[model samples]
Target chain A: EAGVAQSPRYKIIEKRQSVAFWCNPISGHATLYWYQQILGQGPKLLIQFQNNGVVDDSQLPKDRFSAERLKGVDSTLKIQPAKLEDSAVYLCASSFGRTGGKETQYFGPGTRLLVL
Target chain B: SQKIEQNSEALNIQEGKTATLTCNYTNYSPAYLQWYRQDPGRGPVFLLLIRENEKEKRKERLKVTFDTTLKQSLFHITASQPADSATYLCALGSDSWGKLQFGAGTQVVVTP
Candidate 1:
């Protein structure tokens, strides 16, 4: 079984520039998630998708950040007009959507975005 | 104002000793709490999960104790080794499906 895969392990962009991160979840996993982790902090949930439908995105910055899980397997998170404050690691994870049981999430090597 | 807090400072413990880490939260009633281990430059890996109804859960040398009334969780690694050095994160999962709130994470360093 393959683990969750992400592209561009590291990225650098200037302030006000746009950046995008992509994630390919584990096969047969029904749930996918995107999180942002600032230095010295835990990963913060940005968005969650269950079978192509968004389950939650309350912490997402609607003004600049957006994400989509197309066809329920591949997902992408984009931040337009990136700010220096957005310099942090973006993590992607996937889990089996099992009801009435604990779902353990498998994470991918995160993309480190450094905004100048 | 909901918040989950873990020790921001790194904990230094000698190998073969027990290492204990604490996670405390306020303003949230979580159905389950989870622990994850993360090394530098990598994502976190799930270690353990304890439900609200359960008082304690153990796996190998890892033990997690949850006290709902106190809103605290303690993670203990017995017979600890230098390989156990990493940042440990605590996450809260509420009744709302797929929602997990994480703390700032606590780093543990074990020296030989």
Candidate 2:
């Protein structure tokens, strides 16, 4: 019944620093996703996880970004050695399941990251 | 490479009128198309979704039409109000489930 929840609604770090974000998805949801949204642009998928296993991560900057869904209920996305260009809102979303067609993604408030 | 596009310019309309936004794609056939509304400082909220086979879907005052041949989707909001003012994004699903390609949103402002 609860919506997706994300922590550290706002984050500020200098370039070359590290930051991490946490998300609690809706109960029973099995599909989770992380997205980066720059101002005036759509949210770009960074990675996707299906119950602790990654399904897609081609867009993720593996050199600096990593995410994990330990127990399939919650997820964490981390960015290390941040660049000034890494400044954006990190959004976490979840869906009902893999087989649910046209499954709507429920989003959290998102964590705003500012790399100075 | 697949590409999705929405009007980069903001759309401004008078309240009680119908507001229409467009999304166009190229180089890929989508299985389904989705629309979401986003406000400043928040994440996008799902609004409507229409499958490739479906030509149109409606919810209350919101309507979405998808044309695979044209590779476009149009989102409409009837009797628009200030509350309807926000950035609307269109998304197309990838071959794999849960992988969606999104378009840059079109900001709509309904002025009374």
Best by DockQ: 2
Model 2, B51-85: lDDT tens per residue? 99999999999999999999999999999999999
lDDT digits (tens) for residues B1-112 of candidate 1: 9999999999999999999999999999989999999999999999999999999999999999999999999999999999999999999998545567889999999999
TM-score of the A chain in candidate 1: the value is 0.97
In angstroms, the error of model 1 at B26 is 0.5
DockQ comparisons of all candidates to the true complex:
0.64, 0.69
lDDT of 2 at B16: 99
Model 2 bad stretches (over 4 Å): none
Grade the docking of candidate 1. Answer: medium
- Residue-wise C-alpha lDDT for candidate 2, range A14-80, written one tens digit per residue: 9999999999999999999999999888999999898999989999999999999999989999999
